[model samples]
Target: MACYRVVLIPVDENWTPASPDDVPPQPPQPNERLLETEDFFSAVREAIQFNQQTWSERKGRWAVVCEVGCPGKTWPGLRICTPLRYKIASIWWPPGWEPNSPLDMPLCICRTHGTLQEDQLSYEQALATIQALNQQAMDRASTMWYVMLAVENEPVSRTISYDPAGLQTTVEIRRLHVAQPAGGGHGDCSHCPARSLDCSMVAPA
Candidate 1:
């Protein structure tokens, strides 16, 4: 089962009600909740392994693991396998691809369905669900493209990097570009292809 603990550090400035010492108590700072239970680690490990196997079978390639975190951050105390330690990986996939293709495979359990509540599913159950979803996708597709697997303490701090060989497994990751469609009717001049068509199309005098 997954267990999490949120630590609160008092911030002097933000704490209301001045203390007897004539100083305001600080607001509580949030610390990363540590995963302390052995069962929790086991579940996480199982999930990772299940995801890895699912990706490999569906994509025909193993996911790549990447090291993350600052030098001194306490090892979140997860009890996963050694090889998977400190290495967050991903299964890359192309966009708009067929099912079973790497492109259509689910990246991770956490990603497929947002982070779990404090203690929703045991790590094993989460992994199992992820594997089941991935297999379902693979069973439907003939050739998949790419999939990415990543691990990080917080989603914001997570980043995608290339391997030592300077080779990238994913064509593009975490980067998005969008273009507006052309205007069809009048008045939307900014997107009009033809410059002659002004706001009021009543032929210029």
Candidate 2:
């Protein structure tokens, strides 16, 4: 298991825009940077340079470090520092619709900051946390929520043909919500509006 720390730096200049756009601004997208370690200040400086020189934008003023991947041992929860957007699958993905295998089903209920890991938090929690936080206070970065999760280390085996470096077996650490409510596709929502056409809790006829 590996613990990766990455800083999610914003690309917009004004932290608080005058007005909200018709569609809310999207969060930063995570990349292989989670696996790379340069340094804190160095990473931030690079982000600033990239924004200024590459994109011609004077952004990257704020950044928050997020721990990605899994730890060796079991942990109760993980804190997500970046601003995340809560989302659910549309009616297009009607209940019981498994586009892929169970392991590969698309996200139905999840909290995300466009990162590699899906930070699962109820919509109520996500809304309240973002509202309570003072968007202007960079010092309150630590005042984020710790999303409860269940971590498992599974062993996997694979066959390799190359003899020079034959390493095909490894242990994978999987993290998931301890007990995601069945409501999204299984039953009534624990906390949400009454089932409607657009409601995620609605089941297929």
User: For model 1, how does the per-residue alpha-carbon lDDT over 60-111 read when each residue is reduced to its tens digit?
Assistant: 2211111223121223332112122121123333233234221233211122
Local accuracy by lDDT, each model: 0.27, 0.30
- Per-model TM-score, in order, reads 0.20, 0.20
Residue 34 error for model 1, in Å? 27
Instruction: Put down candidate 2 lDDT per residue, 60-117, tens digits, no spaces.
Output: 4333333344221212122232222332221122244232111122234344323223
Residue 54 lDDT in model 2?
28
In terms of lDDT, model 2 sits at 0.30
| CA RMSD of each candidate after superposition | 23.9, 18.0
